[model samples]
Target: MRWSIEVFFKEAKSLLGLGKSQARDFASQIASISITVLQYNVLGTVKRFKSYETIGGLFHEATDGAVQLSVTDRIWGILQELVMIIAEAFQIDDERVMDTLINRSETFKHFINLDKLELKQAA
Candidate 1:
């Protein structure tokens, strides 16, 4: 248990930016820590579902621009495009569709980050 805790802290410091905050205010420090923990949790979920055995390995893959998108990445991109295409074809509002998807469920919102998705209509 202690070893696991140490490993987690090590990864948090090195990869997750846990102790890298320069904020001087208490609230800002707390916010920074919270954000770091949230980032760590998201990465942990990715590591669990993906083939990565270490957070470092996952981070490397995510940051390496030379690496080609995996099938899952390609599928996600296609899904985004499909959503836009469907909205255009059906004369539906793209932002409304995204808002619906994002507000529909917490799990969907968490996985897709739909709020951050910028839907650009094809001109």
Candidate 2:
């Protein structure tokens, strides 16, 4: 049982793309790790529902059945998930992410000014 658990970790990190990290910043790394953990949880949950021995088979069973989802719907869902994930990573509870960006670069400051102008116009 313990040996198989070690193999599972090795396979999960290598075969399942868990050990890969391309983030250039600390917050981004934290968020990427968080998202990876979320993905692992989802995969494990899907695996639990199937009797299949392979992870690919579990994915096939999850998506190949009734109620086929459209590509647009999936894209939208992915975008929404990324937004929520990024927001959580940014820890922007009261202030906008744009506010934080104002200190990051001149480009972000310009964008924040433009955004404020737009908000002023809307109000």
Candidate 3:
């Protein structure tokens, strides 16, 4: 269940640039996120039907569906993408790195510091 939601957010951010929008005006930024969510929801509903038709009004078509891949399979897919990104960033072979960062004892301090910084900025 968590994986499904994670995948949704990942797709939303990656495909639609939800939080990555660069609109200068506040209203435009809000509208940017709103449009991203709208696109995500519409595609999610359409994906439920296993048909990728681009016809109009199909966004309101029957939703409540599942992907062809299982949740575990989907998670593995995400992990593979992450691995590729990190490997390329680090100049390492894709197979050579089993990268774990936030959970490591040495990196937890940095994670907490970043979380604190984000919270402070948000507040």
Find the candidate with the highest lDDT and give its number.
1
lDDT of 2 by residue, 8-121 (tens): 666557545665788789898787767766765686776777563576555456556648668867975875676567778977542454345457779867866898999999
User: What residue runs in model 3 are displaced by over 4 Å at the alpha carbon?
Assistant: 51-123
Model 3, position 55: C-alpha lDDT score: 22
Ranking by lDDT: 1, 3, 2
- Which pairs clash in model 1? none
lDDT tens digits, residue span 1-123, model 1 = 999789888998998788788988999999998987887788789999987668888767766865788897898799788879889999998778777877997987776654345433322
Summed over model 1, clashes come to 0
Q: What C-alpha lDDT, on a 0 to 100 scale, does residue 113 get in candidate 3?
A: 88
What TM-score, to 2 decimals, does candidate 3 have? 0.38
Instruction: Give the alpha-carbon lDDT of every model.
Output: 0.81, 0.67, 0.71
Identify the runs in model 1 with alpha carbons over 4 angstroms from their true place.
65-123
- What TM value does model 1 have? 0.49
By TM-score rank, best first, the candidates go 1, 2, 3
lDDT at position 72, candidate 3: 65
Clashing pairs in model 2? Answer: none
Poorest lDDT segment (10 consecutive residues) of candidate 1: 114-123
